[model samples]
Target: MFQYVFGIPFTLLKFLLLWFWGTLKRLIPYALRWKKSIANEIVLITGGGSGIGRQTALYFARAGATLVLWDVNPDGNAETARLVRDCGMKAYTYTCDVTKREEVYRVAQRVKEEVGTVFILVNNAGIVSGKQFLHLTDEEIIKTMDVNTMAHFWTLRAFLPDMVRSNQGHVVTISSLLGESAVGGLSDYCTSKFAVRGLHDAILREMSVLDSQVKCTVVCPFGVSTGMFDGVKLRHEFLLPFMAPEYVGRKIVQAVLTDTEVLYLPPYVQLLVIAKTILPTSAQLVLEDIIKLNEATKTFTGRRQDTPKKEN
Candidate 1:
């Protein structure tokens, strides 16, 4: 009993010291602009046909990584591959709907046989209905969940085993700020993002238990100009400006190279997450009203039907 009691203070002190050391380690790399090279890495990106996915593929191509793009739209996927080829890097495209589990497995096997094992996997494909709870059709809700949430599970299951065995890989999850703090007019979308965020955290924990070197990053950014949230608007643009797709893509590549665990674009979004956790329910509602978070998506038109879906 005496040893346990006396050890408490020592334990707390050790914890604080370790926390400081970890913070210092993170800062040193940022200060030095240090990033690991991904040259010759095999990168597989879902929804790589458009928006952030396409932009990220371009960035990786510039870094000498071979890209394998999977998307439901053949035209957009082909265009992305063409762009990568223009960069003088190898690029392969496959038309596969991520929402289908069997299709994902089949395509994943083909990628293994044809392109080689993926060293980095970006689960960037997503869709948003931008509909209110009652207004959302059952099909729309299911589709949102399938594309944004279940698709992660399918891809991870198909690829993570090889990564674990090799002890080398990176997994990137493109979530949303709405996943951290919910608002109105996008119940289905918010639900999907939140689910993915949770899944990402769980994967991190499991990876730690397995003592794996495979890194995981989950990104939560505000509305980006990716066409997925085309008409969405924020009341205070100065407080939280809409991010450009290129900027987001660049940041995501940086995070993966640096092995950043969790990234919040604009950075201040992390403060909002803290506020959501600490504030009272009424206070939170008032803050949301001021920011017009609930009304921001009222004007959301999303992607046009004729165009390929914007996968971020």
Candidate 2:
């Protein structure tokens, strides 16, 4: 009884100290700005054909990292490789459907043999069906889960072992703000994003338990100007503007270099997450209504049929 009494206070004090230290770290711009070099690191990105993935690949290329791009669209993948090479960096392209486990493993082996081990694996491939729950078809739901959630498992299974063996690697998961908060007309998309978030968190914990040096970062951004959510609009644009692909790309690269574990783009989205946790159910509904959360996706005309699906 005496030990418990003393230990509880000590733990509380420790928590306060840690929180203060963390806040201080964030406040010190110079401290956070110090970034590690990725020069010559082999960086592989799924859905590198266009949008955020392509932009991120370009940034990594500029940083002197060799890039391996995987996508279902050969033409788009080739275009991305061309852009990387235009930056005076080496780039290899492979056409692979990330949703297929066998294809992921096979292509991964080819990457290992031809391009060498990937030091950074960016699981950025994702698709969204902007339909109400009842409007969504079985095929659409399955494809959404397969591309957004199951693909992560397949790619990680194929490549994470090497990272664990070498004890050096980084995994970046491109989640979304919807992953943290549910909204109407995006039930399938939300389900997949939530699953990936859970997967990323579980893997992070496992890495911690194993004392592994491999780092993981999960990015949750608001609606980006990427064609995927082209017509989607937030009710409060001034407070939460749709992010540019370039801005999101640059921030993601910065996060990787700085070893940031979780990133909420525009930063203010973090406050919304906090609000969701603290507010009662009725209060939350009121808040969502005020924000017109459900209406935001009412006009969501996703990427065009002719356009290649891009990373979120």
Each prediction's whole-model lDDT (CA): 0.89, 0.89
**Clashes (N, CA, C under 3 Å) per candidate:** 0, 0
Q: How would you encode candidate 1's per-residue C-alpha lDDT over 1-312 as one tens digit per residue?
A: 223345576667777888997677656755476689999999999999888899999999988899999998898899999999999999999999999999999999999999899989999999888878989999999999999999999999999999999999999999999898888998998999999999999998999999999999999998788888778787777888888888888888888888888889877789999998899989999988887988987897878877644555
Clashes of 2: 0
* Native-referenced Cα lDDT, model 1: 0.89
Error of 1 at 74 (Å): 1.0
TM agreement with the true structure for every prediction: 0.93, 0.92
Cα RMSD of predicted structure 2: 2.8
Model 1 bad stretches (over 4 Å) = 1-14, 25-31
